[model samples]
Target: MTPGALLDLTDATPDPARMRHERHARLVASMREDGVDALLLLGQANAGYATGVRVPACEQARALHRRPVALVTADGADPHLWTWYPDGAPAGLRADHVHPGLRLEFDADARALVSAVHDVCPTGAVAVDEWTMPLRAAFDHPVGDAGPTIGRAKLQKTADELACMRRAQRINEAAVADVKAMLAPGVRGTDLTARLLERAFALGATGNTVDPIWQVMPSSIASGPHTLTGDVIFPLCTTTEPFARGDVIWVDNGLQFAGYQSDFGHTWIVGGAPDATKRAQCARYRAVVDAVVDAMRPGVTARDLTRVARAVEDGRRTPWLAHFYLGHGAGTESAEAPLVGTDLGDAFDETVVLLPGMVLVLEPVIWDDGHSGFRAEDVVAVTETGAERLSSLDFSDYESTR
Candidate 1:
């Protein structure tokens, strides 16, 4: 049995200072174009992208009050970060630019934040990603939504950003190795999450973005959780339900390294090898991913990817979850722009033109109803010629000897 290797994987490294510098430059350039004098980033991913702060794994509510914030100016100076994670701050960030976490729940804190923004821009416009009532009430000047400008800046990744993603995938795949080694008929779904997280943190994963999904799918959609669309349910919460012989487990997980996220998904058969029909599903899924990856190049539209994937499906329901998407961008956020085949529809897809340096995570599901199915994510970095595979898991590449 063989495992897929990280494409050009690197060993351990220090903070990615150059990546942070380049990202800050992009943010500044975007802010200047948008006429945004200052950026007040409260969203976790946005803040991380602006400042390169590696926030720890925490529940969302807990992360909110304690989350790091970044304030970027059009001057192209270092982005100021207010955070509880002083160590996670990028090495090149100015010492004066770092500060303690702001507790915006307090009125004074909200006013202080407004003051901070005013300090930088004074009369110029400030852009904000999120806002609290307190923050909104305290503002003395007009502001724009930071999402548009920030999204534009982050659409294309830099060389160092690709390196960080590669490092992240390497760590995530290593953890999956341990989890796969322990799979057996008696193992429970939550049990797999335990091993995955344990191994990930041990291998240097900085955070777990979402609870691992180890849903044991049924033979058909009816036998699974009831859905409005009768489509096969995926990603049901992980539970202690122990596995039996030939249980089909759909594993999906996300974790972080230096603020960049890693996405992983694969179908694992318990106790026995995949039957012939199951292998067919795997083959179809692979074909869809291959077609999409082959078509990944600069100027390609997201519609082209969905079209190729649908051609492989041959009129079957879209190869991805109806509720989710065929592919999404992976970077500071687990899922971002350029999503393919989502509810946004064909018009939206046409507008999303692929650019070099955009990372795409394509997860195609091949569910052969009565026989069960296969789903897995393939992460690729769009390049000038085509795309580079970032993830290491291939459903055909057995992770362990059974």
Candidate 2:
């Protein structure tokens, strides 16, 4: 066993096991409403959210992260966590205290899974994350459509869930600071990213849902978003071409602390005077983001907010340059419902309204060949009056790194 290093930050204790039971009850209630007898969660994030178990199967040792599935057959009955490896541990020591009703059991085939469900649910509607079940395994029984129900539940985060997300944001801010300090000319991209990863663990991050992605594009490389290797790297832009005076460096990364993920992007210039166009561009993006953040309140529609952001962006010289919405909600997933975009339909229902406990990501960016990309992402909580920013880091100045 590789001895784990002691961390300065206290390990996040798992929520009361009862929380899982409560969530299970809620899931089962929803499942029953849909006439489903059992709900099978195959996705790791969903499984972990449902049972607090966070281990991957041996087959998932590659780039893919594996999460064991948990089958909840009844509204209040014990749920079975099926996995080849049952005793694996999670960051919050969730495995140590399984709910009195939730337990892990080994399964070699679909027959065992069917047998287990039959023992409890007997006969009724069955549901599963269709994407996860194999064709052969799915043939064992008929399942109902659970996509909408599960997605809606996942999209609307509870107060306790928002608290966990804030913890993630805190860790993410520190990791970003560490990445910035590691930036310098001549530093290898891999080395820079490695340091950021070290800092993440050192600062008490319980490994991220995804690896910290940092890609340092050399100025020699065209200044384009695609230049990123689709992952985080250090010295954000190549130090080989070391950020020169007046050169713009783009940084895009998602800081995952705890189980939540925060996506943010900003562009910085090595040494340059404020150019009128650059200053205006930065201000435009910031204003749109600010408006969206301020616009969040109970009873407001996500689409309306996106429209507001787009209108603000369109006022600028490059109207359509800023295409997407100002931001989205971040919890177990990076991009979930209540999105500030028009493309999303009832998934971001305005009637749902903002609850005081709801947490969301406020990020808006503008990118054009003539100008660079600039955006700020922060976690915020909805209050009675409006929305309150949760991130403590300074994001006021986005044009320069100093």
Candidate 3:
């Protein structure tokens, strides 16, 4: 496998077994480095990443009681999982290593978890992604945060992981094409969502990560929803509100496959044509993304990217939402580490250094104020040489307007 390869979409499929094994190896290495004896991942994506386990998509409240729990030790054995879906576990793990689901929020289940954990590792620093009150009170071990260990391990993508992302994005884009074709003055936000989700499922999407966002942006911030930060409230919850001609709709969403999530974002003008003013805004948005990407490579900091993005923005409203970020890493989860141009300030961005294998979703926005705006997302993988585009969707709407 090529290390630090530029991520691209291909017809080649990855072996799920190999991907799980490699990913586990990386987690083990990070665990060893961090002196973590065991990892108890309660988060859905974290558990799925630790083991090749899949659960049907559900709301957070339902998932809490029913979530799969993964236990990995520094001993480098297959994951020991307490999962509701035993069939979802990989074949590499023995049946004994897979146990019935644990109701971790209750004291009874926490006791069982404590016993099971002690039975295996008995001693070492334990890392946990989440904790309940009962869990903390019952299993009194040296519990540390799993963020650092998980972060380091997930920071770099294995070749197989990149391949999964490419396939997922391909499905997302193809499905989105259908939505774009059907966009019109009479279409509601839900109409776009229904079309995209249906097409995605047909295209082999395993699940939907986020409720599809088809926000019809207002002509001005004052005309839109009230925001304490005064930043444009993008991705406002979808409603039955129908689209009107010239309405600028910004879409952002995630589709899942093999536990990896694909992020798709782009702005569309209702009725398929944009005025010259809106078209100019789209061009400016592209320039900012280009400048940031041109400056992207191994060793660059998020500060460097933000600086370039802002420079190209030429003193606009930050080229991104003040509440959100210019870009973020993508993996098993929709958004993860190394965030850029966030409210976290320059000091934080300085700490986020670009490295090979890191996948980024850069979303630069261009607002014309009284007349709506333009925005879209582009996925790129930082390689040994430079940033490679993982997303292939082009600025078709912008081009048509031009």
TM-score of 1: 0.95
Q: Per-residue lDDT of 91-134 in model 1, one digit per residue for the tens?
A: 77889989998988778989998988888888888889998778
Best by TM-score: 3
Local accuracy of candidate 2 as per-residue lDDT tens digits, 174-277: 66666666555444445645776687667666555544333433333253345334312223333333444555555555555445565555555444443665
CA lDDT for candidate 3: 0.86
Hey, what RMSD does candidate 3 come out at? 3.9
Worst 10 residues of 2 by lDDT: 1-10
The count of backbone overlaps in candidate 2 is 8
Score residue 48 of candidate 1 by CA lDDT.
90
Each candidate: what lDDT? 0.86, 0.56, 0.86
Q: List candidate 1 segments past 4 Å from native.
A: 1-8, 11-15, 397-402
Ranking by lDDT: 3, 1, 2
lDDT digits (tens) for residues 1-402 of candidate 3: 122223334642568989999999999999999999999898888999998898988988888889999999999998888888877877877788888998888999998898877777787788898887788888775688998898899999888888888888888888887778888898898988889888888878889989999998998999998999997887788899889987888999999878888999988888857788877888898888888889999999999999999888765678888888999999988999979989899999999999999999998888878988888999998989998887876676567734
Candidates 1 and 2 compared by lDDT, better number: 1
Candidate 2 local Cα displacement, residue 126, angstroms: 0.7
Task: Tell me how many clashing residue pairs each candidate has.
Answer: 0, 8, 0
Q: Candidate 1: RMSD over Cα atoms?
A: 2.4
